[model samples]
Target: MTSSLRERRRQHLRDEILAAAQALIAERGYAAMSMEELAAQVGISKPTLYSHFSAKEELVIAMATQAMERLFAVVDDGDPPRRSALERLADLLRTGVQVQMDRQVTAMHLWMPEIVQMMKSRDESLTQLCRIDAVVVDLVRQAHLHGEIAAGLDESVVVRIFYALFMSPNVARLSLVNSPDPETMPDAVAHFFLRGVAAGKA
Candidate 1:
């Protein structure tokens, strides 16, 4: 019982650290966020922060891994055949954007060149990103097979389009535009993406 309690406390601290890291990364770009500021924000000593994550790169890689794992969970939600691939893709994109909005960041910021290069150096984080790509690739292929997407459209191009739409910064700045309400922003984005990539009637 004592051991379990200690493990839980350790996990809780780890979560707090990750949350602080995300907030800091949102406030300042990855290049500007510092471990000192993170430790101060989390109310933990530098030594304690070091104990949880040996370095900033490790912490940010862990953050990227966690974010990918979260999206993977949504992707693997066991209802693949019940929904259209296009619908599932849109929903997944919506969830991704909503999650980033909740974290006070955008997908583009989290995936800037600096962060992407660092993530590439980490095998675990890279693998998680690849898994997500594979899933999206399969969805794009399904979308093609179902005639929901243009038959001649390259699957790779469609996949890239999906990422591009998902990475739009405008979704995070809804209030600044004459756009739909926050509650409906996800739906609006999904609709916009779908229409742009629809099979016909362009």
Candidate 2:
């Protein structure tokens, strides 16, 4: 019981730290954000925060990884996946777009140069990213099989388009036309995935 309680406390602290780091990075970008401010925002002393994360880079890595874990969790709900492949694909896009905007950050901000280099250097992280890509590719195939995606479009083309849509939110910020708000963007992207944009997808 004591060990369990200690583990719970540790998990709780880690969660709080990750959240604080994400918020700070979102508001100020990782480069400009200070560790002291992050600690203060979380109502913890610098030493306490350091105990959880040895350095700002480590905290940034952990925060980013946790966000990806949550993204993966959205799709990994069951053995066979509780949702249809198309639905899961949509969910993944939606979650990725929503969290970044809601937290008020950009994809580039989260993926800074050193952080990108770090992830690239880590074999495990690369494998995880590739696994996600494979899952998404499988979903595109399933979508085609179900007649959900347009026929005659190359599977590779459809997959590439889907990947493009995942990053559409980053582009949406620059649009002067009717851009979907966060609440509506997911459905809008799903529509665009199934139907061409000219077909009146939001």
Candidate 3:
């Protein structure tokens, strides 16, 4: 019982460390989040942090891995509740944007060769990414078939539109022309994206 309790406490501390790292990465880019800063932020010694994560890159990759796992969970839930592919895709998009803005995370940034290489060395991160791509493309096709999107628009174009609108890192300033606040920015972008693909919408 004592050993089990100790393990649980260790796991809890590791979770706290990851949470701190994620928050810092949101405020500052991954490249800017240092080990010393992370340790200080988590209120742990450098040696303890090192024991949890051998290096910064490893921690960042772990973050990406967790993000991807969550995304897959979102994607998996879509079709099970018998939701339309379009609705499923929208849920995925909104949650994805929230993850990036709030948690400073997304597999999108992991496409870099250095990071990709690390992920590839893991439990098939590349395969997981490809699976996500396949799911997105399939969803686009479903939306097009159901006339949820504009007429005559190719699947690729629709995919690009969805990604461009949903993947804003600095989203607060996104509506400079229309002058919407950060809170309204997400809805505005969603409207624009959907409108472009919306049937009979100008």
Best-fitting candidate, scored by lDDT:
1
What lDDT score is found at residue 162 in candidate 3?
78
Tens-digit lDDT track of model 1 for 1-202: 6999999999999999998888787788767989999999999999999999999888777776766777877888877467899888988888766655555553445666787788877887788878888888898888888899865678888888888777665444555655335577667778887887778846
Residue 54's C-alpha lDDT in candidate 1? 91
Which scores greater on lDDT, model 1 or model 3?
A: 1
Q: Rank the candidates by TM-score, best first.
A: 1, 2, 3
Candidates in order, TM-scores: namely 0.84, 0.78, 0.74
Score candidate 2 by TM-score against the native. Answer: 0.78
Candidate 2, residue 200: lDDT: 25
Residue 163 lDDT in model 1?
85
Model 1 residue pairs with clashes: none
Better of 2 and 3 by TM-score: 2
Q: Which prediction has the highest TM-score against the true structure? A: 1
Kindly report which residue stretches of model 2 are placed more than 4 angstroms away from their true locations once superposed: 79-84, 106-108, 111-117, 145-147, 174-180, 197-202
lDDT by residue (149-199, candidate 3, tens digit) is 778888898888777766664343344554234455556665666667777
Model 2 root-mean-square deviation: 3.7
| Steric overlap count per candidate | 0, 0, 2
Question: Candidate 3: where is the Cα deviation over 4 Å?
Answer: 2-7, 26-29, 78-81, 104-123, 171-182
State the C-alpha lDDT per candidate: 0.77, 0.72, 0.73
